[model samples]
Target: MITISVCMIVKNEEKVLERCLKSLKPIADEFIIIDTGSSDKTKQIALKYTDKVYNYEWQNDFSHARNYSFSKASKDYIYTADADEVIDDTNIERFVKLKKAMLPEVEIVQMKYTNQLQYGTTYNYETEYRPKLFKRVREFMWINPIHETVNLEPVIYNSDIEIIHMPVMSHANRDFKQIQKVIQSNIRLSKKLFIMYAKELFIAGEDKDFLEAKQYFQNAIENETRGLDEIKAAQCVLTKCARLMKDHNLLLKNSLKNFADNKPSAEVCFELGEYFFEEQDYVEAAIWYYNAAFETECELNIHYAGDYPLKQLANIYQLLGNKELEEEYNRLFSKWELPKSPDA
Candidate 1:
């Protein structure tokens, strides 16, 4: 059986650090904890488990801390874990079995990261595969008989083990601050970060947060280098920002751009529904809400398409004195569940 080192970077995690360590103790041959300026008893709790606890200054870069933690692992494989994660008894047995029977050629192992939707964070899915384990040292291999070439791609294995995520609070506020800092530093956000920023704003941002992000997304709308999806994401952010700020001209401009594409997102449709609803135009609001719930796909929060617009439609029908439609929409809203996949 191959040995495994569990490596983690933590800060002010005294509440959950011991619980996570106890759950992972059975499978870990060594524990490497890199504390990034923790004022709590997190380091003390970690020292009780292993002597590999080390302190690292907070660099505002999670990758740097993670790399430092991985560097301390002396075992055959490194298992990356977080303070908010836990493995139940059933999965612990599965992990032990995997360690004993894993193929030598497999350089990376993916495990199911579950319980995401419970916190209503940035993620849309409840469960998804994430790379959790990796071989500490890589071996280069030559392939092909005639023309020898080095194998570049790492062999990946998908495991059935599941890690339960149990965070005490949503990290959206902290993430927004970090994103703002990145933007203020004049660094261009990558396509992935741009999408994540937009999704987070829709999921958990308040009016002030959206307003602060207004200029950045407005610039994104005019930037020709961004892809179609990025443009749509930018429009979604700007539409909500405009609505919150009560800027009618800006709202119309962004909403019309989306309509011209013939593929408005559910978020934009819902914003328009809210705009009309506030103006007491019940009929127009109902039209936009219906389009949101039935016609368009959601780019950010799934609730905009699922329960959010459905609830609005029910309310609009009730205001319009249509008992039949009101009851129908209420029933649909109650039965609506978040889709397992984004495409669903």
Candidate 2:
């Protein structure tokens, strides 16, 4: 079996650190923790897990701290975890089995990162698989300070091992402060980073900063190489801009454009239908809404894409005072099994 070293860089995460460590300590051959100026009991908790805790000065660069943590891995393979992340017991078993069967040539392994589900009361956490494991000999390095990404050449091996991220607490002002740092540092924000930074600004409710982000997003889209995902991202930002600026016409235009290119995404069609419905253009709105109700395969959408159209059709029929049509639409809506939204 190949030995695996779990390395993590954390600071002031006293509430979450112990739980994360307790979940994986038994499985990991070595536990290396790098503390970046913690003013809490983070280091104390880490000491209980392993003797490999080291202090790293805060440089406002996550990658730098992470790379330092990576350097401390002495095992054949290196795994990374956040102070708030934990692998479930099932995944732990799989990881142990995979470690036993690992081949020397495997350079990297991608594990699923599951985020909290806020879509419904049931809250089914969804997992996104990403590269998190690496061969120590591969000399893998992390890039970027905030939103750091590992550079994986060729292809990274994919695995079903999943990790759960549970944030116990966070610095509420982190986004605005971080963006201010990036902007003030005179660092050139790349297309990718600029979009991410803009999102942070929007969520922080910094309108002025969001405007600055909008300009950056527009510039990024104009100068980008026009990849599939990039176009979708650009469209999303443009739609957000239209919504923020309250230009309903612009929103409709972007939505139509998105539908024309991408396979009528649920969001795009819904927005378009919403605009038309608000304008009381019943015919067009019904058509778009119906398209939205049938386009995507997302489980959360459940029968929403199917049921929404029927429900809206019922509403429209009622509004038109067509009793028979309304009853027919209602019957159709009632016949199918529909999935409820977070509120529903």
Candidate 3:
């Protein structure tokens, strides 16, 4: 029966703030919100929940705002969430039970943030573990200007409680150009930063930016030292970039290199299927695609790593005039997301 404070920093989150607050209200003992210069009714909506609302001048650094919000928390445990995020009804009971059963030594509680579920949605998503719930200790401070992280002990306890994040609005980085400025000034020098740069480029959707992104990912892979996740993420990006760049040799090289590893990483199976398909090797390509659709697990940078391959297989079978295989995969893919009934 420990008290938990829900701490959050928000700006112009009016659209989804009410929904987020309502869902968290029953679970959290106290609400501590820091407004970062919202022109909208976000603050007005927040005040309905608690009087603990405080104002801070908008800072480009997210960690600053997050740290400041957590500082105001008076509870034993601090849980963080975004306006675009919600703890769904299915997990609410489990969440409360977990909170009640929490022990003293639990420094960080890692919950799955399902950015995208099932697949075939308007937006991309994957299940990622985030330390949203943590003990209210000063040592677990957040870091970084962008993609901020809290340094926590390796003793992370995974919780079954889940959170769904679907952005109701877009706050496209006003700081993208500034990040580029800092990168150019040599203020940031690291493989992580290069990965971030490549990510930004991948999001930009330009032909030239894709090529530049490939180079940045290449740099990350070459310079990184034994950071396996970072290297795998870079390879994930590079494999796709090679495909887009139409460099078949590079694609095969990287995909095979990925497959050569003891365990196949994210999107490698799908990429191999794509590579073989492009080489006009239909049988092998079908085998790879079938493996992707049914067998291997993926945590790829792409959203819907599970469903995307099945959809691709469905299309490939359609092109090959294999209606039996096409319909089977199409059924598998459609089972993920079904359109809502207008009346329901």
Candidate 4:
């Protein structure tokens, strides 16, 4: 069986640290815990599992901490995990079997990350594949009989093992601060970071959070090189920010940009619903809410297309004294389930 080193970076994770370490103890050959300024018993709990626990100064960057922890690993493979993650007995058995059967050429192992929507994190899906295991060292090989060429792509294996994520609290507030720091540093956000920032805003950002992100997204809209999807995401953020700040002109400008594509995002539709609803235009609000629930796909926060607008439509109908329609929408709202990822 391939030896595995469990590497983790934590800060003040006293509550869940022991539970996480105990669950992983059976499968892990060694634990490399790098504490980043924990004021709690997190380090004490980590030391009980392994003597490899070390302190690293808190840097705002996660990659630096993660890299430091990985550097401490002295095994064939590295299994990176968080304090909020737990592997059940059944999956533990599966993990052991995977270690024994792992191919030498596989450089990365992906496992299912579940329980994402419990705290309404940035992710859209309840479960998705995330790379958890990595080979300590990669071996390059030449391929093809006639025209030999070095294979540069890492051989990835998707495993059935699922890691349960049970965070004690949502990290959205902390994440927003980190994102704002990056924006304030005058660093350009990559496309992935840009989308993630937008998703986080839609999922859990407050009015102040949106306000902080306004300038960056506005700049993104005027960049001219950003793709349609990025532009749409920027528009969605700006639209929400405008509504919150009560800037009607900004709201209309961004919302119109969304409508110019002929297919509006459910987020914008829901925002318009709320705007009209606030103005006591129940009929207009119902139209937009209907569009949010049925006429458009959501770019972020599936609730906009699911329970959110359905509940709104139900309330609107109740206010309009349409009992039959109100009952129908309420029933739909009650039955709404999170939509599966397209690939799922």
Better of 3 and 4 by lDDT: 4
Order of models, best lDDT first: 1, 4, 3, 2
- For every candidate in turn, the CA RMSD to the true structure comes to 1.9, 8.0, 8.2, 1.4
Summing lDDT over every window of 10 consecutive residues in candidate 3, give the lowest-scoring window.
116-125
Against the true structure, what is each candidate's TM-score? 0.95, 0.69, 0.67, 0.96
lDDT of 1 by residue, 1-344 (tens): 99999999999999999999999999999999999889999999999999999989987767789999988999999999999999999999999999999899999999999898766558888888889999999999999997899999999998999999988888889899988988988989999999999999998898899999999999988999999999999999999988888999999999999888888899999999999999999999999999999999999988998899999999999999999999999999999986685321
Candidate 3 lDDT for residue 166: 74
**How many Å off is the CA of 82 in candidate 2?**
1.5
Q: Can you write out model 3's per-residue Cα lDDT over 1-344, one digit (the tens) per residue?
A: 87899999988899899999999998889999999899999999999999999999865567788989988999988999888888888888989898789877787888877764432122233666668888886455677899999866445688888888877533324434545455556554455555555444433335555564565567657863637766766776777778777787878777777767666654667767777788877777777777765565553434225567778788888888999989998998888653332221
lDDT score, candidate 4: 0.92
lDDT for position 104 in model 1: 95
Clashes of each: 0, 1, 1, 0
Candidate 4: segments with Cα more than 4 A from true spot: none
Question: Least lDDT summed over 10 consecutive residues: which range in candidate 4?
Answer: 335-344
- Report the lDDT tens digits of candidate 4 across residue range 59-109: 788989999999999999999999999999999999999989999989999
Candidate 3: residue 187 Cα off by (Å): 6.5
Steric clash pairs (candidate 2): 293-305
What C-alpha lDDT, on a 0 to 100 scale, does residue 74 get in candidate 3?
A: 94
Clashing residue pairs found in predicted model 4: none
Worst 10 residues of 2 by lDDT: 116-125
The regions of model 3 sitting more than 4 angstroms off are: 26-30, 57-59, 87-105, 109-130, 138-166, 169-212, 224-226, 262-266, 275-291, 294-306, 323-344
